[model samples]
Target: MPGVDHCLQEAMAIPGAVGASIVDYTTGFPVATTGAAPNSDHEAAAAGTADVIQAANSRSLFVSAMPHDLLEDLIITTAGGYHLLRMVQTEFDSRLVLYVWLDRVQGNLAVARRRMQKLADELVAT
Candidate 1:
C-alpha cells in the first residue's frame, strides 16, 4: 500500500485534481495534506468539515431517518472547484476521511471519485 504522502500525490495526478488530504474525523485533524493554495489553512478546514459532517448526521437522526449505513462519500461543487470528502471506515471507533479539491474546468468528477475510493482501500492506519 502507498504511504499517505504518496496517496495524496497520486490523487493530484488525477486529471484536474488540485489538492488532497487524509483527515481524522473524530478530531478534525489532518494526518497528511498536499497541494492546497499558499495561504490555505488546513487545520481550520478540517475542523469545519468535521462539524459539517456531524451536523448532517444529526439532522438525519432528527428527521426520524437512520443515517446511511455509512457516509461513504460527499461532494460539494463551487464556482471555482469541486470538493470531495470520503469517510474511511477503519476497524476502530476512530474514522478517517479523504478530502480532495479538484479544478472544475479540468476535473472529471466520476473518475476522481473512483480514484479516491481505490486509494482509500489501500490506505492503512499506522
Candidate 2:
C-alpha cells in the first residue's frame, strides 16, 4: 500500500499534471502535496477547493435522489487547465479529496479522471 507521499508522486506522474495534493476538506488543509501549485500558494488553493466541495455537498442540486448515492468526483475546467477533485472514500466519516491540476492543452481529461479514480480507490488500503 502507498502512503500519502507515494500516492502524490503517482498522481504527479500523470501526463500534464501541474500539481497534486491530498486535502482535508473539512478543514481546508492540505495533507500532502507535490509539484507546482496555483498562484504558487497551496494553502489558498486547498481552502478554495474545500469551499467548492462544501458547497456541493450542502446543495440539494448536487445531491441525488438515491439515498445511498454519494458525491464521487468533480472536474472544473478553466481556460488554462483542468482542476480535478476526487472524493476519497474511507471506512469512516473523514472528509478528504484528492486534487490534481493539469494543463488543458496537454492533459487528457479521460485519462486523468480514470487515473484519479484508481488512486483514490487504492488509498483505502493504506
Candidate 3:
C-alpha cells in the first residue's frame, strides 16, 4: 500500500495541484500535509473542512434518516483554485479524508478526482 507521503506526492503531481493534506475527520486534524501556501494555516483549513462536512451532514434532513455513513467526497471552487476532499472509509469508526488544492488554470478536476479515489483506496494506515 502507498504511504501517506507517497500519496501526497502523487497528488501534488496532478495538474494544477498546489497543496494536499490527509486529515482525520473524527478529530479534525491533519495526519499529513504537503505544499502549503506561504503563510497559510493548513491545520485550520483541515479543521474547518471537517466542520463544514459535519455541519452539512447534521443539517441535512436526508442525511438524518440514513445511517451515519461517512461523507465520500466534497469539491469547492475558489477564484484561484479548486478544493477536493475525499473520505477514506475504514473498518474502524474513524474516517480519513484527503484535502487537495488545485489551481483552476492548471488543474483537471476529473483526473484529480479519479486519482484521489485511487490513492484513498491504496492508503494503508499504520
Candidate 4:
C-alpha cells in the first residue's frame, strides 16, 4: 500500500492538479502536501479544509437519512478552480481528508473526483 506522501504524489498526477494534501480534519493539520497551495500558503489551506469538513459534519443539512451513511466527499467550485475533498475511511474512526486543487479551465471534475476517491482508499489500505 502507498503511504501518505505517495498518495499525494499520485493525486498531483491528475490532470490540471495544482496542489494536493492529506489533512487531519480533527486538528486542521496537514500530514502531507505537494505542489502550490492557494495563496501559496499550505497551512491556511489545510485549516480552511478542516473547517469546511467540520461544518459539513456538524450540520444536518448535508447528512443522509439512510442507515450508516456517512459523508464521502465534497467539491467546491470557484470561478478559477475546483476544490476536491475526499474522506479517508479506515478501520477505526478516520479523520483524514484528501484535498486537491485543480484549474477549472483544464481539469475534468469527473475524472478528478473519481481518482481522488481511489487515492483516498489507497491511503488507508494496509
Top lDDT hit: 2
Candidate 4: stretches off by over 4 Å? none
Please give the distance, in angstroms, between residue 121's alpha carbon in candidate 4 and its true position after superposition. 1.0
TM-score, model 2 to reference: 0.95
Q: How well does model 1 score by local distance difference test?
A: 0.80
C-alpha displacement of 29 in model 1, angstroms? 1.1
Per-candidate TM equals: 0.85, 0.95, 0.85, 0.94
Q: For model 1, what is the error of residue 101's alpha carbon versus the real structure, in angstroms, after optimal superposition?
A: 0.4
Kindly list the per-residue Cα lDDT of model 2 for residues 1-126, writing each as its tens digit.
788888899999999999999999999999888998999999999999999998888875756657868889999999999999999999988899999999999999999999999998988865
Cα lDDT tens digits for candidate 1, 1-126: 588788899988989988888888778888888888314888888887777667665555543355446567888898888889887767867668898889999998999999999888777655
lDDT against the true structure, each candidate:
0.80, 0.92, 0.82, 0.91
Question: What would the per-residue lDDT of candidate 4 be over residues 50-84, giving only the tens digit for each residue?
Answer: 99999888776646657677899999999999999
Q: Could you give candidate 3's per-residue lDDT for residues 1-126 as a string of tens digits?
A: 577799899989988899999888767898898998424988888888788677766676655475776467888888888899887877677667888999999998999999999888888544
- Residue 96 lDDT in candidate 2: 97
Candidate 4 or 3, higher TM-score: 4
Runs of candidate 1 with Cα error greater than 4 angstroms are: 37-39, 61-68
How far residue 108's Cα lies from its native spot in candidate 3, in Å, is 1.2
Worst 10 residues of 4 by lDDT: 59-68
Task: State model 2's lDDT.
Answer: 0.92
